[model samples]
Target: MFRFLNIVIISLITSIVSAQGYYDVTKYGIPNDSTFVGKNAIDNIIQKAVQKGGGTIYFPAGKYLTGSIKLESNITIFIDAGAELHFSDDFDNYIPMVPSRWEGTTVINFSPFFYAYKAKNITITGRGLIDGHGRNWWNYSEGFDDKKPKSKWENTFFENNKNVLAPPDSKWLKRGFLRPPFIQPMYCENVLIEGITIQNSPFWTVNPEFCKNVTVRSVTINNPHSPNTDGINPESCSYVHISDCHISVGDDCITIKSGKDEDGRKQAAPAEDYVITNCTMLSGHGGVVIGSEMSGGVRNIAISNCIFDGTDRGIRIKSTRGRGGVVENIRVDNIIMHNIKQQAFVLDTRYAKSTIGPVSERTPIFRNIHISNVTANTKDAVFINGLEEMPIEDVSFSNIHLEAENGFDIHYSKNISLNNVFFSGVKTSLVKIENSSDIDLKYLKLEKSTEEKPWVSAINVDGLFIDGCRPKKGTKTFLQLSGKTTSNIGFGTNDFRNVSQVVVKDYDVKKDAILK
Candidate 1:
């Protein structure tokens, strides 16, 4: 897709760790035939590479059936154009659980499908396929829908770590022995994953945890409707750049996570400085999602030039009360979404049900996010709900158009700005605002048929401003304001052409609350 920047620099592969060499797997006595267990032969090749300081482990055109492969420092696994590494489906091969983060909490679980720990300058690239035979894992986990029983390992994990897991997502213990990521490099530096097509991940595909200076491009991740098989997730990492990827997964297409509630708060490392662009998303829950797992924090991300087709939402940022994270400084632009199943965009703070406690370190925050130049054909659009105690702040939208059945539903948010926006095919009201203040709507457009109801409804809103929203044909009572708390409403230079009345106030609202 982005061929100009398609290839990784050679120094990224051969430098920063040691001298470089090349070792072919076939020369190590593993036949081209795919039947043999390739664990020993691949490990032998890796050992030779480590002995020579660093090298490229080559896999030529054929299938190699293997179990978990541990990556080492200063190494690259370059699969030829037709080569495929087919991971085994047996759960036992991944066991004697390793210490890794499962969902957000740290636990000893299955070895990552392909993993490295604290390594440096590692690369896995080439035009080949890395397939995780994930059907067995899904049948063991998400197959609860088909009425299957939990495996023995599930119970064993629950018996081991049940005391330590104080979960906002407490449901993890029930499934137990959590599924491993398709590819994970933990605590690594200068990592690059590119040009490979991955399929049928057991859990999240292309997940790098606690890694720095990571880049993933030109990769294709296609997983069916199994459970928790997200396409690409970068957790608690810094300086990440993801581009030119195609994803159609069972869950979210690309998600950024810092950590879970308590464990993440202890680590306190925010995932920062990410640039994601030029990606195509087909089927998933959300096109780009940030957290329900953010307890440490997430900030400074820019996403642009993306296409989301047949996904559930376009941009989703979610957190609960107990996960105390701040998601801010996010910018999304030049995006197209088609056939969105649910609301196209959302920033939900009360994502999970925890007893509403005092505003402490556990309270999550969302602020200073800007989205522009977006077009979506969705069922519903723009659902943003924040906590009453700590509302979402400083969110702005410009040049947005949506063809949808329903429209914006905003609650407990402040400092909102919508400029040059159009909502077409809206069966219900265009906007519904409650318990929010300082909302400015400029150049707003909507299509409405039955004119008895109000097109714009606001309740308990203060400091509302409407400007430059003039259309040729308009209905009576365009805006309806209610609630004793609604005050300081103003209209600036709006043409109410072909309309009888423009403002309507209920008994609760004072007449002086609105000014034009």
Candidate 2:
């Protein structure tokens, strides 16, 4: 039944191509052989379509090998069922570099396999295969992100292509073999990528940068353990809707970004107003991630109805100091996760390259986020970390049912509320908190164990409140407070009859800090 439903959805999605006048590639004398390099023929066909005021270029029921395809405005490439659009593995096919962005930095690199720039009303649809033969690209580019390479030099690769590599300061000139994305539509509007299976990506797959009104639906992306092969990365784009996609790649499945540090701040474009729903992810770093590259700020994202299985983390939002971005107004609901290798939910703002300074534009900010209706089985339940200077603010978690090996950890945050949370299999001693304020726990059902453990352990924390929460039967300690700075803790209307003690404190904390 689900398969039939998918068929119906794909048929509906492909309707836009069906309505257009099609120029079949068979009629253009392109080779039918799978090994043929029909780059010129394909380019000529695209030119002809553009000359005729734009039309659908159709490839029907065969394997066609080609290189980079540059799309024009109002053009649609419809690959019919049983058709495979395979990209050539030869590096020479991607010569005469194009303007592109790689990992948040703008550069003139190898042409993306399917690229569109400043285009409007473009689409790639139909039930077909878009394969990037990327094994060779992966091998040649290995061990080069390192500043010092082990092997000797390839001077020609750098000397001949030095001018194309941008920023001059970038390491891309050194690693001249930085592979291109499978599909990247930059600065385009009204873009759609639907009803296709894309695999073997050399780098990111289905990446739409600086584009608006983008929709990627019913697309399946499968990449093996290739380096940096992310799926469905929409960077610096707005009004994006990504739904009904299946992704399993080496890196983050769906990474939302707005570029990185200095360049990102210069671009000053946030990847905001996004809706990601009804997607299934498998064997990736994070199911749905937002930035380690969000210096341009990311906001107003809503993700729902997603299933993540065998991913490293379920929902991850990560950035660091010196990023100079604000990530806020995010909502995540109705997510199911299993076999999460790391934390089920994490919001970390200290990833890499942090420096001590007064709070300014360099300090990344996270605020106004809510996550609810999540069920997960994972190694750790939650990990939330914020900076000391700029704490993460106004975050909420509700209706979460989780079975994790470790307990929750939070630090340097404020205005956090956890409601209707059911947690089990917590092997760690306490739900630890440090250097935070205004934390409220309501209607929580934490697992009870015979081991000596405190329900919550806090240090240097203030404005902590617990309401309508019942402790597991026969728990030893209710609250363990430490540090002389800790104060203003209130046990508000909670059932602690089965617990032994109300407050257990270290030598530094005063008993007057507790209000029961």
Candidate 3:
């Protein structure tokens, strides 16, 4: 039934495209010398295309400076190589707010520099540049304060019972939750954005919301090291294929987000079945981030053959307590991280802002995660902290080699498995597991970087299994509670003198030994 539904949807879209008239952009409007400079050439072309039933609007190789350019159905805007389509810096040029999506809400938002909405079979493909000319707008939006560092985007809420309020002093507009996204294409389908250098956006770049069959490949995304400049944010979309792309931005290189909190839960629209492969991220906050805005929930994501260099964190999955959603069945493989500043792999569920609130409807769940063959040189090897109230489960980490400042820290989780993993840290504990259950640690080696602080062990689990692992003796310690020990089992060369309930196979027994 679902397959049939998909087919019907595709057919309906095709019919709509056929019904629309098609016109070329250059034929409808020409860029002459007199009207070329400061002329609304792009708007004129788009209007003509819309009037004549949308078709491919071509941008030939030259510099075209204008304000916001709107896209229509069946319109394919082709930007050839050496073409530089720049956005005007005047704010009033983008006035008359258009229907758009900001943060998570659907509002009459400020239009993107290049905007498209509810369009079909739209293609913005070429080896050219679609520069947002964001520095002017970004500076202006932040009140043009050069002395202080500015942000890429800002979020503001509407007060006074859904009425549009102006910027004021007392009830002044403070920063809201949702950051504005750049290159926004909302409710668009059959989209193809290939081989374009989409850069310098004022905010999060390449945002495709409620879109489908979107193929973004061979694109180079370069932005300033500012706040909220994400490369691509595919929110509430499906069948997305992102490959052969080079992303270097201020925020997450490629982030997948849905909605946030109660607003997200009410939407209940998941961003599912997306594939990202063979991509390289040069510098960013995160290599790939799956949101705290996932109120609509996310599932069935696969990422492979990715390289992260000089990033703050790699493979980061972060969410708050109240955001209620389930992010499961994620598979990441063949990842290589170099010079990661923070934790190489992290699942932080305690992303709270106010530090106090009820269990929000946006409480999210992360489980059934499988990661393998990940090599990294970083400050911290691994960091996984589930919600103390709700434990994360069914996670596996295998064949990971880390050269870092700290070791693994796993807390408040269940059904955890670690195999063939090694960590080398001089001043920190090699492994620390607390308030967990069914942990299977096998073929592990925790080596000391220097003799100052040797390999220290802190394992607190209900059921634990240690097999074929090598940890430095004399300094390794274990602490436990009697009621917490369910089954402490080991395979070869077992050391369980400090454990409460212990069973060993082929181990030299040292009875009444103090574990430290």
Candidate 4:
């Protein structure tokens, strides 16, 4: 039966490749052995294939070193097992600062090592390696000798400094601020990247911006935990499928961002219809992140069957007020997390440089988020903070066994539901909602791990509900409601009659004194 299944799969793949039209790179001077300096050879082959109206460029079994290469339309690059393509580290070789798009605008800048622009039907497939030789670029200005540590470059933080802007003033200057991506393709369509080992990027790896109909499968992207070295960042792309990829890097493992604020809002192009499954994230800021730079808004994203280990956070969505974006229709399920240092989930709406600016129409809005079936050990189970002027709405959490040290904190939100959620903490409220409305908690089991730190009922909200909930033995202050409604007509003690509806069942609750 297994043999038959393998045969069927092979037949399907063969059919697909044959239909796509294959052209071997060896015919264009790419050597089968590791000794050949086939820099221009394979390039000529690709050009020939493009001139002949599209085909595949197969790299079969060798260590190939070359400078920057551009991919044309309707061409596929297939690197077989035991093949490695090491990019040239000499900055002078990558000349002219070609016409490329950075962030949002098209500008004359350093081209990506492997880039495709406004092209269609491109694929980079097979089990091989694309090494970025980043240490050479990182140490390009450090004046390090051959005797220095091979891992020294990975320890530096290059993204924070503002000196290295995109399209550096001169190639000779060591402006480390620019985190040059390894494999980037912008404004392309119908792209597929699968089954490759991509590593050692000087900046973000595997970035596809402003693209469509993209698919990334069975790929391993690894970088040495350097600053701004995010993996598989799909920005401003639509109809994307990223599955079976193991990403471990310095920054967010898989960050989904649309665009920067102001510029991104003006563009008005949302990154939508993306699905990520069967992936693993080892160490990073967040396992799967949706951006602080998402000014163009993001919607319709689903991530399932993922694992996160030793990350700062998991399933994070970050944006700021005045960013002018909308993030909605997000679903995350079937995740296992271990050793998460921060909150399991975060919805931070004030992410940028804080300022006292008038709430412009560009202020962002977050709603319709659902997370379920997650088992995590973290510091905080959840943290949701919305701007007072623009509150988040319609969020739900179900089937979560989150063991955290800091419980949960929510502020300036509405219409939240927590079902079948268990929290183990002490000296803190199992849940706290401040300046919120329509909050519901059902089947909540709060356990106290320490007696000195008694759990407190310091939650304050409007229209709150507590049904089928179990409180720990040391829980203090059953419930408190404060806020005036109407004039001099306090209804009853321990019950809020004039205020909005606040219901608590299967437990005792405190009532406020009526004032007339």
Put down candidate 4 lDDT per residue, 151-196, tens digits, no spaces: 3222232222223233222332243223357778888999999999
Which stretch of 10 consecutive residues in model 4 shows the poorest summed lDDT?
Answer: 485-494
Model 1 TM-score on a 0 to 1 scale: 0.93
lDDT of each: 0.87, 0.87, 0.71, 0.73
TM-score of each: 0.93, 0.92, 0.81, 0.81
Order of candidates by TM-score, top first? 1, 2, 4, 3
For candidate 3, write residues 145-248 as lDDT tens digits: 43454332322223211443221221213432132355778889888888999878878888888888888899999996666688988888888999999999
Full-model lDDT, candidate 4: 0.73
Those runs of model 3 whose alpha carbons end farther than 4 Å from true positions after fitting are: 1-40, 50-53, 141-180, 353-360, 446-456, 471-516
Q: Tell me which of candidates 2 and 3 scores higher on TM-score.
A: 2
lDDT score of residue 254 within candidate 3: 92
The Cα error of candidate 1 at residue 227, in Å, is 1.0
RMSD of each: 5.7, 5.9, 9.1, 7.9
Candidate 4 segments whose C-alpha is farther than 4 A from its true place: 1-21, 32-39, 99-106, 139-177, 425-427, 448-460, 472-477, 480-516
> Can you write out model 1's per-residue Cα lDDT over 1-516, one digit (the tens) per residue?
455444545455534433448777887887666788787678788888998888998889998888888899998999889999899898877866777887788887788978899999999999999999999888867644323565677766666565565574566665556788999999999999999999999999998999999999999999988788999899999999999999999999999999999998988888999999999999999999999999989999999999999999889999999889899999999999999999899999988776666899999999999999999999998988998889999999999999998888899999999898898888776788999999998998875542665667999999899999775364656788999999999989888875566888889998789864
**If both were scored by TM-score, which would come out higher, candidate 2 or candidate 4?**
2
Choose the strongest candidate by TM-score. Answer: 1
